[model samples]
Target chain A: MTNLSAELRQYLIITASYWTFTLTDGALRMLVLLYFHQLGYEPLQIALLFIFYEFFGVVTNLVGGWLGARQA
Target chain B: MNIGLALQVVALGMLMLPSSALTVAWVMAAQGLSGIAKDLNKMSAKSAIKFLVTDNAQGTLFRWVALLTGSKNALKGAGFFLGGTLLVLVGFRTAMVVMAAALAIVWLINLIALQSDLGKSASKPKFRQVFSKSSAINRLSLCRLFLFASRDVWFVIALPVYLAATLGWEFSKVGGFMAIWIIGYGAVQAIAPYLTGLRAGRVPDGRDAMLWALPLAAAPALIAYTLNSQFEAELILVGGLLLFGFLFAINSSLHSYLIVSYADRDGASLDVGFYYMANAMGRLIGTLLSGWLYQVWGLQACLWISALFIVVTAALSISLPRSGSTLPTTQ
Candidate 1:
C-alpha cells in the first residue's frame, strides 16, 4: 500500500467507498421490500414502493453523465 | 458529501418514524430519494474506473471492470441477507439507524481519504453533447434498454413479494433465496469473459452478444409455462431463475464491456452515462410492469413480458457492428 502510486491509491479508495455504498443500497432495498410486505401491503402495493425509485433512476443517469463531463 | 448527507437524513427520518406514518406514499417517497442517491454513486464510480485502468491493456480493462461490478453485486447479495437479519434481530427502525450510522462512517472515510479531483476533465463538455452521436452507440443503448427490462421485469418487485405472498415463504426464506440468486448472478458476471472465451483472445462482438442473449428469452417463457401448468411452482420458478441469472450475467457483462469500449476517452462518461440511462429506463419499465402485472394477473404475465423484451433485445443485437461504435453502419 505504501509503495503504490498516488493514482492507484486513489483508485482503491474510490472503489472501496463504492463497494460500501452498494452494500447499504442492497440492504436498504431488502429492508423496504420485507418491511412493507410485513405490514400487509398487497404485492402490487409493495411493488409501488419502488416506482419512484426506479423512475428517478433514469433521470439520474442522464443528468449524472452530463455532470460528470462538466466537472472541473 | 452531499449524497451522503442526504442519505443520512433520509435514514434518520425512517429511523424515527411512527408506525402510522408508514403509508405507501411515505415509503415510496423515501425510496425515490434513495434511488437518486444510488445512481449518483453508481455513475461516479463507473466513470472513475476508466481513469483507474491503463489504456493499452484491453484485457486488464475488461477484467477490472468485471471485477469491480461483480464484487459490488456479491456484496449487494450479502446486503440482502444483512437487511433480513437486521430486521429479524433489531427490527425496522433500529436497522435504519444502524445502516445510517455505517454509511456516515463510509462518507467520512471517502471524504478524508479519496482524492477530491478524481474525475474532473480538462475541458468541460457542453450540455448538448450529452447525447451520443454514434449510431452504434444509439443502437447498443437500445439493446441495453430491452435487455435490462427483460431481467428486472421479473426480478425486482415480483419475485420476492410473490414468494412471500403465493408460496407462503417467510421473509427470511425469500431474502435468502434472493441473496443466493443475486450472488450466483454476480459470480457468473465475474467469470463471463472466461465463459465467452476471452482467454482465446476473442473480445466479445455483436455476434457474441446475440448468441448469449438468444437463449435467455426461452428460460422465462419456460418458467412462466411451468408455473401456469402447476408443475411444482416453487422448484420450477426458483430453479428457472438460477438458469436465467447465469445467461443474463453473460449477456450483461458483454454489454458492460462494449459500453466501456465504445466510449470516447475524453468524456467517456458521456457515452457510458447515455447507455446506463437507457438501462435505468428499462429497469423503470420492468419495475412498473412487475408490480402491475403481478398484481393484476400473476408472475406469469411478468415472465411473458420479460420474454418479449428479450426478443426485442436480440433483434437489436443482430445489427450491431463487430467492434467499436465508431464503425460504419454494417447495414
Candidate 2:
C-alpha cells in the first residue's frame, strides 16, 4: 500500500466504497420488496414502498452536486 | 462518502425493528435515507474519476468509466440475489442486521484511509452552477433522463409483476431471472467499447448515441407486437427482454462514458451530479408510470410507454454534438 502512488490508492478506495455501497443498496431493495410481499401487501402497495426511495434519489442528485462542490 | 456508507448502515438498522413497528411509513422513511445515501456515494465516486485520469486519454476514460459502471451494476444484481436468499434463509431482520454491520465496517475503513483533498476546486462553484451551463451537457442530461426512464418504466414494476402473476413464476425464480439479466447486462456494459467499435480506435459520439437508440426503440414495440399476435408469450418475453437488455446495456455504457468525457476538468461533480439528477428523475417518473400504466393498461401499455420514451431519447440524441466538434458554451 505504501509503494502505490497516491492517485492509484485513492481510486482503489473509491471503487471499493462504491462496490460495497451498491451491493447493500441492491440487497436492501430486494429484502424490502420480498419481505413486504410475504406480509401479504398488495403488489401496488409494495411498489408504493419504493416511491420515497426513488423520490429522494431525485432530490439527492439535484442538490448533492452543490454539496460536493462546497466541499471541493 | 464515508457519511454515505454510514447512513446506509443506519437505514438498514431502521428496518431491523420489530415487525409490529415496521409500518409502510417507517419503511418509506428508511428507504428515503438509503436512497440519499446511495446517490451521495455515487456522486462522490463518479466525480473522483475525473481527477484520476490525465487529459487526452479518451480511450482510458471510456474503459475506466465502463468498468466502474459495469461492475457496480453486476454487484447490484448480486445484491438482489443476496437479498432474496437471505430473506428465505435468515429472514428479514437478521438480514438487515448482517448488511448494516458489514457496511459499518466499510465506512470506518473509508473514513480512516481516504484522503481529504481529492476533488477540491480552487474556486467554489455557486449554487446555480449545479444546473450545468453547457448545452452539450444539458442535452446529454435530457437524453439520459429519458433513456433511463425507458428502462425503468418497464423493468421496475411491470416486468417483475408480469413474470410473477401472468407467467406464474415462483418468487425465487423471478428474483434469480432478474439477477441474471442485470448481471448479463453489466457484463455487456463492461465490454461495450469493443461492441461499439473501440477496437478500431473509434469512440462514440452523439451520432452513435442516436444510431444505437434506434434499434433499442424497436425492441419493446416488437415484443408488444408479437405478444398481440398470440405467439407463445413466455418465449417472446424472455427473448425480447434479452435483446432489450443487450442494446440498453450498450446505450447506458456509452452515456456513462460520454458524461465523464464532457464534464469540465475542474469540479466535474457539478455536471456529473446534475446529469445523475436527471437520471434519478427519470427513474422516479418511470417507477410512477410503471405502477400506473401496468394497473390501467397492463404490461403491453407499459411497453408502449417505454418505446415512446426511447423515441424521445433518440430524438434528443440527434442534437448531441459529435466528438471533437466545438459545442455551444451556453444553454
Candidate 3:
C-alpha cells in the first residue's frame, strides 16, 4: 500500500511534467514559423521548408518509437 | 487501412496547399512531439503494471491515470482549434513566434516537473530488441507500409490540385476545407470513448465497429463532387466533414486498441519510431504521388481516387482480427 502511494506520486509528477512540455513545445513550433517568415521566405518557400521539417520528423519519430519500444 | 495511416495521408495532402511554412512546421512538430508523448505513455503503463504486480492498489491508481491520458486527446483537439484559429487571425508569423515561445516554456516545465525516473534512461533495452522478439509487430509494420504506399500518393498530392481546378477554390479556401475536415475529425475523437460504449452491444466487437463506420467515412468527399452549385457543394462538403469526424472517432479508437493490446499481450511496446516511420513514409509517398496525379489527371479524377483509397482502407479494416473490446490496454 505504501509503495503504491509512492508510485502514484511519481506517476503524477511525471504526467504533469510531460503535459507542460507538450504545451510549450506546441508554442515553440509556432515561434519557429514566425522566425522563418520574418527571414523573407515566400509562401512556396515556406511550404518547402515544411516539407523538410516533415522529412526530419519522419526520421526522428522512427528513432524515438524504436527507442521507446526497447525501453519498455 | 489503419486510421493513423489514413490521417497521415490526409496531413501530407494538406501540405500541398499554399499554406505558410509556419503551419507546416507546426504540424510536423506536433507529429514529432506526439511520437515522444506516446512512448512515454507506454513506458508509464508498463511501470504501473509492474507496481500493480507488487501491490494491487497501485494498479488501480495507474489505470485511472491511463484513462486520464486517453481523455486528454479531446482537450488537445480543442487547443489545436483554438490555436489554429488564433494563428489565422493574428497572421502566420505572429502565431509562429507565440507558439515557439510556448514550446520553450513547455520544455523547461517538463524538465522541472518530472523526476529523473520519467526521463529516458540508458538502461532501457536496445531498439532492435523491441522488434526482434515480435513477429506481429513486423507484420503490422508491413501492413501499414503497404497501405500507406498504395493510398497516400493519390490523396495528398493529386487531390488538392483536383479540388482547385474542378471546384475553383483558392488556396486559402482549400486550407479552410482542410481545417474544417480536421476539426470534424478531432470532434469525433473527443466523443469516441463514450460513443463506443453506447454502441458496444449492437456491434459484435471493436472490429465490427470499424467495419460499420468504414463506408460512411467517404460519404462527404463523394457527395461534395457531385454538387455543382457553390452553396450545394459547401453543404455536401460539410456533411462529409461531419462523417469524417464520426468515422475517424470510431476507427481511431479501434486502431489504438488493437496496437496497444498487441503490445501488452506480447509484453512489447509498439515502436513509436516504426509507427511514425510507416506514417512518414506513407505521407512522403502520398504527397509526391498526389502532386503527380494532379499534373496528369483532372481534379474530378483525383476525388475519385481519394474515394477509392477510402474504400480500400475500410475494406482492410474489416479484415483485422476481432479484439474483444475497444477499451485501450493500459499496460
For lDDT, candidate 1 versus 2, the one ahead is 2
Better of 1 and 3 by TM-score: 1
Superposed on the true chain A, the predicted chain A of model 1 yields a TM-score of: 0.73
Clashing pairs in 1: none
What candidate 3 gets wrong by more than 4 Å, as runs, is: A1-17, A20-48, A52-72, B1-68, B88-90, B108-114, B121-125, B129-210, B213-217, B227-231, B258-277, B283-302, B314-331
Best by TM-score: 1
Indicate which candidate wins on DockQ.
1
Q: What are the per-residue Cα lDDT tens digits for candidate 2 across B241-308?
A: 89999999999888876776666422244534567588888998888788778877889999998999
What are the TM-scores, per candidate, against the unseen true structure?
A: 0.82, 0.79, 0.58
TM-score of chain B of 2: 0.79
Model 1 regions more than 4 Å off: A1-16, A66-72, B43-68, B108-126, B129-131, B258-273, B322-331
In order of TM-score, best first, we have: 1, 2, 3
Per-residue lDDT for B181 in model 1?
A: 88
Task: Return whichever of 2 and 3 wins on lDDT.
Answer: 2
The most accurate candidate by lDDT is 2
Please report, as a value between 0 and 1, the fraction of native contacts recovered by candidate 2: 0.68
On residues B132-182, what C-alpha lDDT tens digit does candidate 3 reach at each position? 245544545444543444344443433333344456655444444444555
DockQ of 2: 0.54
Q: Estimate, for each residue in A1-72, the C-alpha lDDT of model 2 and write its tens digit.
A: 454477778888888878988998888877887777678766566667789889988776666656654555
DockQ of each: 0.60, 0.54, 0.23
